[model samples]
Target: MDFQLTDDQRALKAGVRELLAARFGRERLRAAVDEGPRLDRALWRELGEAGFFALRLPEAEGGVGLGLPEAVLAFEEAGRVLLPGPLIATHLAAGVVDGAATGETVVTAVDGGGLVEWLAEADVVRGEATGAEPLRSVDPLTPLHRVPVSGGAGLADVRPMGSTGALPTAPLTSLFTAAEQLGTAARACETAVQHARTREQFGQPIGAFQAVKHLCAQMLVRVELARAAVYAAAVTADPVDIAAARLLADEAAVRGARDCLQVHGGMGFTWESDVHLCLKRAWTRTQRTGSATESEELLAADLVSGVGR
Candidate 1:
């Protein structure tokens, strides 16, 4: 299968990136950080107008009528900017929930671990989030609520393309989560490289140092590998492939952010720097949908059963 993106796909990805940069630039991101937990309804509506949530919906239903690959591309851009809110949930809810396609309705769901993100702000909660206790999230941008873990009944809105798990929701959720992870990983790599070229130490750029070079190189390798896995999984839509993509993407995001931080040295630890935010968001995203352990378990099971073949 050809891995190269078509012209239209490239255009779509670039358009989303440009839109996000214009709307949620660094200044706006910092402002959002200072403002506390609140969704920018206007920005959300603009994304809706851009067909962000309705990317995969059928044209007959007033959608962009694209496939999962296109949606993944769009979401990768979203992750790059660390766009907050229940993006994946709202996108999944586009056709099912009223006004979701238009970004007028917010939707959230209880994860397998019984956590709901942006629950209070949601116009529709996909799973049972009853008796949820708010948790002080590590990522300030993401406010979280926890419910007691139980055998979660599947939500009606989950449109399963081909899920390997007993619950049909994992395929799209895992794939899209991986796509977001890929974005963060790519952004972290870029940030590290940019800083390495400019920031100096010992009268020369730090990127000249072997340690910094190795870190940035490792980040790039991880990002590329994860990107390939994510794009491939988007095309294949196989459970095992998606599981592998999630595993790789999660590692790339978390580890790449850490490596990026390492390159920034003391500045990365400061609150004013966006580097820390990327790390925190990457950590938080790891817990969403299919966690690393869950993906590993699914892969192990597939290997033992030869189900992937």
Candidate 2:
């Protein structure tokens, strides 16, 4: 089968990228960081107006009438900029919560266990919410609160977003999460290469160094491989496919960021540099929806006995 993106898909990706570049520039991101973890109502509304949070909702529901592939591209842009907040949760909350599609209401989620993000600030929550308190998050861009489980379920106040039975959301989460990882990984590679080209050592550009070349090449390889898996998962959106995609993406984002930091040498770790933020965000994303271990386990189960369903 042809792997090329259709014209519309390419347009969607470009549009999202342009929108993010215009809406969430580096200075704005730093400003947002200074303000801390509260929701950015203006940015959120801009996303809504842009049909970002409602990409997958049926047009009948006043959404964009797009599918997972489109949603993945949009989320890839968000990831590239490291846009904060409960993006996936709010997008998934579209139909279940009135005004969520329009960004008029803010929603957060309690994932299967004690992991609930933005619980304190959400206008509405979905899942079983119970004892909730803020937990310091590694990615300051993402404000999170973990809710203690009660009777085997975590705390959330909104009704379960199921008509009769809940639709499986793992694949959606995994695909979108992987897309985010792909974006971050690409950014890390770009940042490292750009720095290597300009930052000179002993009168020669650092990029001319054999070691730096290898590092940048490896970063590109990881980013491309992860992009392939993420795009494939966006196409299929199968659980096993998503699991595999998430696994590759987790490694690409986390490892790519670390490698980028190494290329930037001492300055990468400073607060003024975005390199550290990428690493932290990648680390944070590795545990969301499914981590490396979780994804590996799922893929292994499916490979060994076709057990994961």
lDDT (CA) for every model shown? 0.88, 0.82
Compose the digit string of candidate 1's lDDT tens values, residues 71-149: 9999999999999999988888778788998899988887766778998888888877777889999998999998866
Considering summed lDDT, which 10 consecutive residues are worst modelled in model 2?
156-165
What's the TM-score of every candidate structure? 0.95, 0.93
- How displaced is residue 250 in candidate 2, in Å? 0.6
Identify the candidate with maximal lDDT. Answer: 1
C-alpha lDDT of residue 83 in model 2: 86
Q: List the candidate 1 regions with Cα displacement exceeding 4 Å.
A: 151-167
Best by TM-score: 1
